[model samples]
Target chain A: MSVTLDQARKIIRQTMAKGEDMKLKPLSVVVLDAGGHVVAFERSDDASPGRFGIAHGKAYGAVMLGMAGTAQMKRAEDQAYFMAAVNGVFGGHVVPVPGGVLLRNAAGKVVGAVGVTGDSSDNDATAAMAGIEAAALVGEI
Target chain B: MSVTLDQARKIIRQTMAKGEDMKLKPLSVVVLDAGGHVVAFERSDDASPGRFGIAHGKAYGAVMLGMAGTAQMKRAEDQAYFMAAVNGVFGGHVVPVPGGVLLRNAAGKVVGAVGVTGDSSDNDATAAMAGIEAAALVGEI
Candidate 1:
């Protein structure tokens, strides 16, 4: 089954809470359904102005590529120009970053993604993974 | 008070439910914070391709102009060039349409906006207003 709206928003909120617990900077989090449509999103009160778009882009990229954001980053590292062109084709929804993770339901079927921004890439990934765990969803970070 | 992530998503989901109840087309809905930053967004599985951007534009226009989408449309009607320029300056975030409405909190202070797209303009406004009401927020349709 696909990720529900409540589940999506819960992932976002839980991820931001994890960031807070780690004393990390405020974060923006986004969740996208398998179809590449936004299901839920939030920006911490102190998050930077552009964090929402960045987080959403990262999530969109993960769902679009059917891989973790870090994996996409690795793929883009060798072909930045190609990746940029790809993003252009999708109206800049693709982000080669480390904070996006693929999410799966209990049955291990990919369902959606969670993206976090505003901390170090490693920390962002950690938070996103934590959110997935909190939701009892499998995650590829 | 600001619109919480839960409230934002609830607004979107309820608006889509309203659309379904009315036998309207599939819809896309968006919610923006007082600062015009997106808080939540959703697109029905069968919604039109560009409905997401259109929905977001409508909400952004309502929040940025401090008026309902219909009012903005009226103002823009007499100054098409000016409206176009405004949208250009904002990177096309403004939409002078009838589907956006301002949301006010308990204190009657404008807190954010909700926008809906899919059916005719009047139907869109009706759906958006219903969502705001469901969220217990005041709305100007």
Candidate 2:
């Protein structure tokens, strides 16, 4: 599956707008290709500078690991050893947070991921999900 | 400027070893290329899974923007608009945290970056610097 630049841009715009409507503070959003390379990113003016990195990592981790950072975090609680081994193997690029939403095609194959930061983790996840749905895509596991 | 997979792996190994000697909890480390692409990553067995993404984003943002995410956070205090514009433009992958260390050559050209998480930002930065220096590379601004 492929994610177009246009689609990524649209996701950013729509997500930002949703953030505005929610009266959330500044935000950072990122979209990644299936290969986990960045396709696009945006940071709101009021967002903390660190928000961008956090958001990007969340998104990239989702794409690379095929799960949300939140979910990964939960699993880490029980499988600390495995998580540590994977982290060492991957060099710490995979995060399991809710803020990351996987993009899936109609056939349900993972295509890409969207990640957001700069608000509560829940809000960030919500915004990313909004963007993915806005792009006419589904957010899967 | 480039950070090869071998150098990145070495950095992670050295950093982890140091962490172990110090009896520090598990850590997550990431190396990024000049283009902010992941070259290598690792998560210590005891580290949180989320640290992986956080570390990767921090490192990528440092390399992409030529500064630490913590410094970027400081800049955001005064330049909210500029920061926001950047967030919008980059789609949220830029972080200005202290854990990010830019890799440079003697010629002072940025080659890549290293980011560490699962510890204080300051400790993460320190470990990253040690790794860079161990690789016989320069880390700066």
Candidate 3:
């Protein structure tokens, strides 16, 4: 389904709830539509002030590459210059981290993505996955 | 209320819906928190790709100056050097135009700002006002 505001809010809610249930730190979450545009975002009360930017960067990176954040990170692993160039061109909107997960529709079409931050990379990924599942979408991260 | 993700999304939705209803050109919109950081943003399907940066710049300018984009433009009038200084210091993240509006909370505190770009500056300002109203926030523009 096309990413709607309701869907975006649902994903954010689910992700933050998962963080709470797992006793993870307060998190920042962001949802982006297929066009690499933000649909929704939230930085929890206890989340670091900088979490919002990092969350958006990760989600934007995932959407731009059409892959998981980790995959992008791996691709940029040996190319520091490439990563730097991306950041320079995009105004620091690329964060190749495990917190970003691509979302797919039932037909396996990439619909959008979710990005989470404020915890360990693995925990952020797990929170994002929980959000994708809660929205009844496939998580590819 | 604080500018939550839901509020930001609502503002964007209302702004774009107004654009559609008015038969205006596609627009790019951005929302920034009180600290002058992006909270959410969108580029309409038909919007020019470059509009994203411009929209963000306008919003950032409004938030940083605690005034409307037009006001900022007026303040910089006849002072090209000042405008250049601002651009240099902020890395060109300021667009003093009519599209940006400062959002205020119930207590009259600046909460965030919204920026729209696509049509004429006046039309952009109208769209931003629509969004702020829809979000139940004060609009200073």
Candidate 4:
């Protein structure tokens, strides 16, 4: 099954909590179901408006790749034209960064994804893992 | 203000219930806040992949119109060039159809819009109304 709204909210909440605990910058988080339709999204009060789109694009790209998002960076570097075309197909919602992670269910099946934005890409990825693990789901970080 | 994630999910849940009750086809639904930012979206397991974009477009069109979307159909017919240009401005995320309905609060303020896709436009409109009503909000259908 794809990510449910409740699960998506939990991921957002836990991501926010992790960001606070880590003293990261104000963050925006997005969770997309397996099919890449947004299930839920939230941005910390101080986050810039652009954070939302960035977070969403990261998750959308990761979900479409069916893999961790950091790998996208290497692809973008090695195959610039391919990455550019893929971004066009997704309306530019693909971010080649470390902030995107996959959400998997008990059977090790990717059911959705969590993307975070605000601080460094590494910090964002850490926050994403924190949230996914806290929600009792597997994180393919 | 704008629609909350909780309210958006409630609308989707109720919309799915209504569709199931009426035995309509598997559906995809979208909820966009007043600013036309997507807040929440969902689709049945078997829904076609294109449903997500269709639902999103319908909701985006209605939210931008800030009025009942059926009026959009008339405008599109009367001023085809303008409608086409407007759609281009929105990156082509506009569906001039009955399934798009604006959401209002108790004060009759436009807060958001909900769009549905799967069945016929009339049935989709019916489902949209059911969702808006169940959420205890007003539907500007």
Candidate 5:
């Protein structure tokens, strides 16, 4: 399942549009390819300056590890050494939270991921999912 | 001023090389384009996955706010509410610390920034600066 940059950009645009339509505060959105490279990104004008990277990092983490960011945080709860090692290794890219979602093709192959920030993790996840669905990509709850 | 993807990748590679030469532990490096969007990034295989996000966040915060992450940390002390607001707005992307450096062009225009983690904040800053220098870009110390 190859994810195109155009699709990623479309997801981001639609997501941002929904956020605006809902009057959600400024948000940051990111899309990653299957290989974990960034495909597209944006930080809303109202979004805090660094929100873009946070969103991207979380999304990148989810895709690379093949798990939710929140799951990683859960794992960190009982494993300081693991957490520290993660901190040491990834240079801080893996953010364990619930704001990211994996994208799958119709064949159920993981194609990419989307991450959103500037809201609760749940809300961020919701927005990302909405975007993915709008793009006709399969996303898991 | 624009920071090219090639320059960003170069920064990460050189920074990682310096870390290896100095016998530092595995490192994660991130480069942010103007407006604080990630332009390019690479995570060492041995580096912890979390380092990727943390490094990017810290660096994004530094450049987005036009100050060193450490300086922001210092200011946050007196402006807890503002800092909290930043955190909320950024959705966990901002890390006020010393591990990131702002990148500038010849005209003193901030074109991008670099962030490194997996060691002391000072060490991270050193690596980030080295990468910036290697790119022939001026770094705001």
Candidate 6:
């Protein structure tokens, strides 16, 4: 299944709402299609310049590797070279930390991914998961 | 036949040999499958580090745009601002210049591409074409 631009925007909006409800810090969010192409992205005014890349790279890496950010983080600890090669091949911007979650359709196929940054990785991941659930989709974080 | 590791290495070897026979500058080459994933890459000792990235990016751009290197170059001239946005959003390293040649199968399906650098764009394109031909593959140069 493919993610439409409207669906991507909805993900971003819901993600931001979750962040606000949790009283998290200023957040940056990015949504990507199955092909790892950006569909929509937004960052609060207080977010730093690096936030965009962090959020984008996180989602991109998740989509490309077919792994959630939390899964990647677990792998990163024992598989140093694997993560190194991943980042190296992908232009060194792949954030293998938490806060990136995959959106799965009812068939369990990965449709897209969402990434959030600017807060703790756990909180960011929580917000991303909530957004995906709120959008009437399943989360594979 | 499908593009395999053997095919990728053959493309790289032929591309480098063509550059050598033509007395071109130290050349770097990259072979990417249709998925835009790197299959193989090699650079001459004298080639700069950036050569690898240039060739990779050029080939990646061509694959993503579904255009040969020359085709992208022509488009770039007419769509300067469009390409500007492409490179800007794509981490600022997409090379729209010539030298990446798409490989087509007997059925006219794009199987992969080879990117060459370290010489003039035209000559690089020529070397890329030669490599594709030597591999018994047709190219959309």
> How many pairs of residues collide in each model?
0, 37, 0, 0, 21, 0
lDDT of 1 at B75: 80
Q: Candidate 6, overall lDDT?
A: 0.79
Instruction: Decide which is better by DockQ, 3 or 6.
Output: 3
Q: Which candidate, 4 or 6, has the higher DockQ?
A: 4
**lDDT values, one for every candidate:** 0.83, 0.73, 0.83, 0.83, 0.76, 0.79
| Predicted candidate 3 versus true structure: per-residue lDDT over B1-141, tens digit per residue | 347767887898899899888888987787888888767776675565467678888888888877788788887897878887988888888998889888998899998889899999889889888888999998888
User: Candidate 6: misplaced stretches above 4 Å?
Assistant: B1-141
| Predicted model with the maximum DockQ | 1
State the TM-score for model 6: 0.52
Model 6 chain A: worst 10 consecutive residues (lDDT sum): A79-88
Instruction: Give the alpha carbon lDDT tens digit for every residue of A61-129 in model 4.
Output: 989988677888778889999989998998787997888888899999989888899999999999999
The per-prediction CA RMSD against the true structure, in angstroms, equals 3.5, 12.9, 3.8, 3.8, 11.4, 14.4
Runs in model 3 deviating more than 4 A are: A1-10, A20-24, A32-40, A63-67, A72-93, A104-112, A134-137, B1-10, B42-51
lDDT tens per residue, model 2, A1-141: 678898898888888888888877677888899998899998875453446566766777677778866776676566756655565565555555567788887888888888887766678777777777788888753
- Reference-based lDDT, residue B27, model 6: 83
Q: A6-53, model 3: which lDDT tens digit per residue? A: 677778889999999999998988888888776667777656668867
Q: Could you list the iRMS of every candidate?
A: 3.0, 11.8, 4.0, 4.1, 7.2, 13.0
Against the true structure, whose TM-score is highest? 1
Query: Residue A116 lDDT in model 3?
Result: 92
Off by over 4 Å in 1: A1-7, A20-24, A76-92, A104-111, A133-137, B1-10, B13-27, B45-49, B76-81, B105-109, B134-136
The residue-by-residue lDDT of candidate 1 on A9-93, one tens digit each, is 6687788889989999988888888777776667776676677789878888888888888888888998889889989888987
lDDT score, residue A35, model 1?
Answer: 77
Interface RMSD of 5: 7.2
